[model samples]
Target: MPRYLISFEKDAMDHIREEDFPEVTKAASAVCQEAEDAGVFVFSDGLSYDDGDVEHAVVAVDGMVTDGPYPESKELIGGIFVVDVPTREAALEWAAKVAVACRCAQDVRKFRGPAGV
Candidate 1:
């Protein structure tokens, strides 16, 4: 089986409202359950923006540690899921379900491991 990553992209400033989040969460949970039943879901989770209490540190060229997102942008990865599936088609189906649940653009890509020397 191959592992695939399904990522949601959204603007941090234009965050989803708390009231609307539950519905999305419910939908996502349902999809996750479906995947689990099919024995494909490995893990899934939503993430907060990389700001405030989300401590981040960056090392500069001179070995100076800086704090914050590097080259910050309006959009950030909001959530993701890692699933083990037998084929790309299966992974794509999962991604479609996730997109409908999250109500956002979902990017699906095959995860890579360490390069063979």
Candidate 2:
């Protein structure tokens, strides 16, 4: 089974009202549940950087550690769902559901397997 990544940009949720988080979470969870029921769920999680609270964020090079992402990205992934499905179309369908549930557009990409395998 091939896995696909389904995610949304962080800025996509910026305009969403804080009070609406509960409803959004509920809706998103339902989609996740549906995926689980279909046996395609690998894993899913949301980033807590919304309030600028990037838990344990750090950068390290040559044993030196710094508190930052070397080069800031204009678009950061807000949440991700990895699903093991048989086809791209199935993955896109899941992404579509995720987009509607999260009230944001979703990005989909297939995962590469072990090198040369």
Candidate 3:
């Protein structure tokens, strides 16, 4: 089986409202459960809003640490799922399910295996 990353992309701050978030969260969790039942789910998690809350770190040549969100972008990786599937087509199907569940766009990509068999 191959591992694939199903990433959900969207403007993190747009859809999250304090009042509506709970319902949305419940729905998302239900979808996750469905994936788990399907035996293709390995792991899944959602990221926090792209506010300054994220602790960013950068490594310098001398191993010094610098901080901040790498660069700014219009969209942020809101969530991701690591799934084990037999083929790319399977991964895409899983991504579609996630997209519909999250009510957002999902990007699926097969993960590269470790160097040298």
How many clashes (backbone N, Cα, C below 3 Å) per candidate? 0, 0, 0
Q: Which regions of candidate 3 are displaced past 4 Å? A: 10-13, 16-18, 50-54, 72-75
Model 1 TM-score? Answer: 0.78
**How far in Å is the alpha carbon of 76 misplaced in model 3?**
3.4
Better of 2 and 3 by lDDT: 2
Each model's Cα RMSD: 2.9, 2.0, 2.6
Candidate with top lDDT is 2
Please report, as a residue range, the 10-residue window in candidate 2 with the lowest summed lDDT: 50-59
| Ten-residue region with minimum lDDT total, candidate 1 | 48-57
TM-score of each: 0.78, 0.86, 0.78
- Please give the distance, in angstroms, between residue 60's alpha carbon in candidate 2 and its true position after superposition: 4.8
Best by TM-score: 2
Q: Evaluate model 2: give its TM-score.
A: 0.86
Residue pairs in candidate 3 whose N, alpha carbon or C atoms collide under 3 angstroms:
none
| Residue pairs in clash, model 2 | none
Candidate 2 lDDT, tens digit per residue, 1-117?
999999998678777899998999999999999999999999999876645555635555666766444555567788999999999999999999999989999999998977887
